[model samples]
Structures are given as C-alpha cells and as structure tokens.
Target: MGIITAGKYEGQHPIHPKARQILLDAFDQGWADPTQISSQGRQAQALLDQARESIAKSLGLKVDEIELWGEPELISPIAIWGAPGFGVSPFIYGATERSEIIGMRGKSKQFFEISVDIDGAIDLELLTQTLQPNSIVAIQSANIETGVIQNIKAIAKAVVAQNAHLHIDATASGARFVKPSYWSTLHFDARSWNGPSGVGVFALKNGARWSNPLPHTRPTRAPNSFSIPLALAAASALEHWIADEAANSTRLKSLIERVRNHVKQTISDVDIAGNAESTLPNIISLSFLNVSSEQLVAELEIEGFSVASGSACVASALEPSHVLKAMGLLTHGNMRINLNHDVQDGEITKLLALLPGIISKLREN
Candidate 1:
C-alpha cells in the first residue's frame, strides 16, 4: 500500500482542489496591499472583502465581525485578550485545551482549570460552579487530540447567565460541524478547514464587548493581517466543505469508529480517548499499554502509513500528550488517526490489519 495521510487535515491538510484553483487565480488579484490607495490595491481589497463575506456566510456571521490573521500562534491569546475582560477577567478553561490558549492563564490573572473525565469531557457542573459574573471562560469546541466534543452551548448558557463571556477554540473541528450560535468570541485556524498554512480567522460577535488586544491605529478590530490569496483559499475550501459536509462528515465518522472498535476489540490493554457519541467524527486517539508511540509511529511510517503519535500541536516536541495524561489515559504508545475527508475504506482496512500485529510485536519487544 502507498503511504496514506491519516493526519487530520486541520492545519496540515492540503488545500482542496477547487480551493487551490481559487488560490492560483487569486494570486494576481490579491497580490497588492489592500490598504494602499491604488487601482490594483482596490482589486486586492475587493478580493479580501469577498473572501471574508464567503467565510461569513459559511459560518453565519456578518463580514465586519470577522478578521483574518496571517499567524495562527497568536490568534488564541489575542482573541482571548479582546474578549469582554482581559487583565481583570478571571479566566477558566478545560484541562485539555491547546497550550497557547491555556498559557494565557498566568498573565498574573485569576484562572481555573475545568477538569475532564477519562473520556476528556469537561465537568459541566463544576464549570458552572466556577463561573464568576462578568468573567471570561475559554474552552475548546472539540479536543484536537482526543476528538472529544464539549457541551459548549450549556457552558455558554451558564457563562451568559452569569453575565460573562465565552471564547471558543474551534480550530480542531471547525467547519466539520455546525458553528455554535452562542459565543462572545470565536477563533479558528484556516488550516483547520483545508486551507493554506499561516492563516487563522476570528470573530467578535456583533454587540459583544471587545477591543484591540494589540496596538493598532486601524479602526478594524483585528490587525487586518493575513495573506490575501491564502484567505481566499481558506474561504473557498470552507465553502466546499460546507457543501459536502453532511456526506463527508458521516464517512469520516464511520471510519474513525471502525478504527476505534477494531483497536479495542483486537488490541490488548489499549486505551481509546473520547466517547464515540460525543466526539468529533473525524479523529481517533489510541494508546497501547507497554508500547512506545515514537517507536510505533516509526514502524507505521516504514509500513507506508503516517499517523500522529502525540499531542497534534506539540507532536514535534516529542512530548507526552497533556490531554491523555490529564484524562488519566496511557500517555505513551499513542496513535492519532485524523481521517482525511477523501480517505478510502481500503486504506483504513489496511491500517487496521497492520495495527494488531504491529502492537503485539512492539509489546513483546
């Protein structure tokens, strides 16, 4: 079998074919600085605005409420900063949220960690109890590594009842599911939706209390920062995804479920993260007892398959997955399967056939 991409395309998936075409066509049109007062610049500005409108329509937002960033790293902190409260707002987030989002906790502000159960579901009751009126709560719409989905609407309800704000990190599962209707601020990576790299999108809900977290003279809420071609590509891919979402999502969900069931029934002493009923349909996180993820990933690579082995965000660091550890699952021997929307059942079947023997041999060694 040929090498297959099981890595969830979030941030890593290549641009969709139609989106790639849009990107190529946009290069000439979007090359000029949209801020400039030239004819070419006006064309670029038009392309940028059109892209934003397309994305807005897909996500159910007005064009003015959205902003694009060329950098993904700073989106979380910046989005959190622009929320209802920043320096004074006591923040609370799930234990499994991305480091960038949770890292903001110690800007010398009060914070709380919403605990997750073994399945990586955050404690909703405890979260409600932790709410402080006029506070800010940061949370993941879905876990990137475990594919666990949160009851953010319920959390949002609690936050709103307390007169607080909600910042949702939908980077992992954005565009795969319906966009949440309730949020003070929302952040998503363009890469999450089969777009080019180095682009992220965020929105401050209309009438939501927000301000520029960074120093800027521009009246726009965000820096108006991003590659114009890439932004168009991202928006185009989102449209394609939305059009095909129902079928694609159902297929991806079925594939992940197959992988989950096979690993549990065939592989001994394996731990699977996330509950099938509540998790995203596209990702599966599995860990085998007494096996090394690094070694497993290498072996799988040699077998013409590529799977993620650690926290997706920090995989290059070769660190233990904070999410698995937080959920009390085996942090070692972890394998994450991110189903590409177009992946074949044969590919998964091949992967399934290889996993049992590979795990057995690794455990024996």
Candidate 2:
C-alpha cells in the first residue's frame, strides 16, 4: 500500500500476519461494553486487559497506572482540571495547546503561557520564573510541527521545586525517543499519550490529584466509547512497533540526514528548523526563501509524493502553524517531511535529486 500517513503503521500497515489474526479475533468477539462486566462484558474485559497489559509492558509501566479514554482531548482536560481525588488540578500553562485548552479559558483563573526561546523550546529561565504553588505545567514533549524536543526532565524538576505538577503531551514523542518508563517518572500528576488518533491513554501517576474538568452524570471518566477491537489493535501496534523502532529509527535518521545535507548543499537560503541533533528522526521542517508551503506541498503531491506542511494534524488550517510562529520563523514556505518505513530509499534519493530542479522551476514561476 501507499506510505502510511497514520500512526506506527506510517507508510505500512502494522498488522503482521499473527497480529492480523488477533485483531480479527477481537472484532469477531464483537461490540460489547467493557465496563458492564456481563458475559459479553467479560469477554470485552479480557480484551481490554490484554490491551492494557501489552501497552503497559511496552512502555515499562504497571497496568493500573494506564487508563483508557475514547477522546484524545479528554485526557488533557481531565488531567489539567480533574479533582485531586480523581487526579485533576487547576494549573494551566500560559502558552497554548489545542481545542481543549481554548475551551477552558473562561473557566481558569490560573491560566498562563510559558515563553519559548528562538528555537521554540520553553525558555528555562522563563519557565522557572512562572512556577507557583499548586500549579500544573503543561508542555508538549516535542513540538508537533518543528520536531523540537523539550527537556521534560529539567521541566519536571523545576515543577517539583515549586511543589507543582507536570503534564506532558507526548503525542509525538511516544515510541520515538522518549520511552514509556521515562514518561512514567517524568509525568507528574497526569500525562496524556496519544497511541493513535482515535485512542488516547491518560496515565495518572499513583498519587497525583485532579479535579473534574468536564461535566457528566455518571462521572464516566473514559472517552472514545471504549472499543475492544481498536484498543487491542492500538496496543498490538504499539508493542510490535516499539520492538521494531531501534532499527527503524536508525534507517529514518539516515533518510533525514540525506534531506539535511541535500538541502544545505543545493538549496540556498532554505531555513531548517529545530536543533538538528535533538529533533525527531522522522521529521524535518524546511522553508525555501520565496516559496509558499502550500504551493510546494501541492507541487510535490502532483509528483506522486506525499508530505505535510507543518503538523499533519493542523495542515488543513490556513493559519501559520502555532509551532513555527512561536519559533519566530516564517510560516509561509515551511514543509515538514515525515518519513515512513515504506518509503523506499530510491524514492528518497529521487526526491532529493529532483528537489533542486523543482525548487528552481517553482522559483521561475
């Protein structure tokens, strides 16, 4: 199939021969709410347990620390706003995240944005200055569009000194550079890890407290309706994918190296974002001197290559990526290339060979 634009299966489906049967078996047992504990629920619960255990083992965490949720956004809000007994807090970071944070603006008195350096990393000095009692600091482990990795270890320490909590959105960092154990220790009261677009895992460190951020009658904390099949698939994908990552990351790093070297050598005035050594191996964000990112993405797609401008999650929006803008870089001409394993080396070499010509041709237009 075409290069996967989705999760761990990026460029290829992660459904190995054995895993495919497991997934189908999960579906065959079919739609039963895992929470019910009936006969059907028992079957569903078994699947859920297997999924939870698999995901936990992959990340080096115990099963109970991980909680399943249907909504990806629910984890963040719940972690930030849930009652202490349930692991919620009133702390809010000054900088922004997504729809959930925006929705809470009117409800929070403690909201604040942490400043970033020119490279889009949180200014450690500024972050240090912002700490307060009972605060919860929200920071993404890696900036989505720029691939800028945050020093969560440092940030966590700073949060602790202030007697506060740390909430890391590891959507982009999970199964990449930050291992599951790193997250278990680094994440303070709560942290949200995105396993796939549809499945979200919110981990509450054993004793962290939170307040309920959202309203519901039963206080049903889980989101995304708890699908047994999707959870099983997601867990299966993560376990197998993590096992495959060491080799894959090495391969992906080589591909990105080619891009970095090719661009530096052939494309004058192109700005590559992030700390090259620390950036995510699979992603590179580059901006040509005078070209629009939209035009470049369209041109490349017409040439039978798929790439994204900024984060894939926000590509459809017209606004310049919050990530690039925050870094004080031009948002107009940025293109983020996220490499997938299915992408052949020949394709990357061809694209690299063709890029200079494409840029020159686009420049003339």
Work out the TM-score per prediction: 0.94, 0.85
**Candidate-wise lDDT, in order:** 0.81, 0.63
Q: Which pairs of residues have clashing backbones in candidate 1?
A: 11-191
Candidate 2 overall Cα lDDT vs. reference?
0.63
Residue-level lDDT tens digits of model 1 in 1-365: 56446554455656789989988998755477778799988887887788889898887778878888888768779888777667677888899999988888887278899899998888999988989886788898898788899877777788888888888888887875455566888888877777788778888888888887788776667676678888888898888877767667778878888998888889889889988998988888888888877788988999888888774333776567788989999888888877767778898899999999999999999
Q: Write the per-residue lDDT of candidate 2 for residues 1-365, one digit (tens) a residue.
A: 24423322132223444455666887887757777768989877877788888877776666777776665556666676653422234455535354454455456655667767666667888788767766667777775566777777777778777767666776666655353222222221101122334566777666665434566667544444755676776687676666666557788788888889989999988878876776887777887877766677777777777666763333676566666676777677677776654557777887788788888887888
Candidate with maximal lDDT: 1
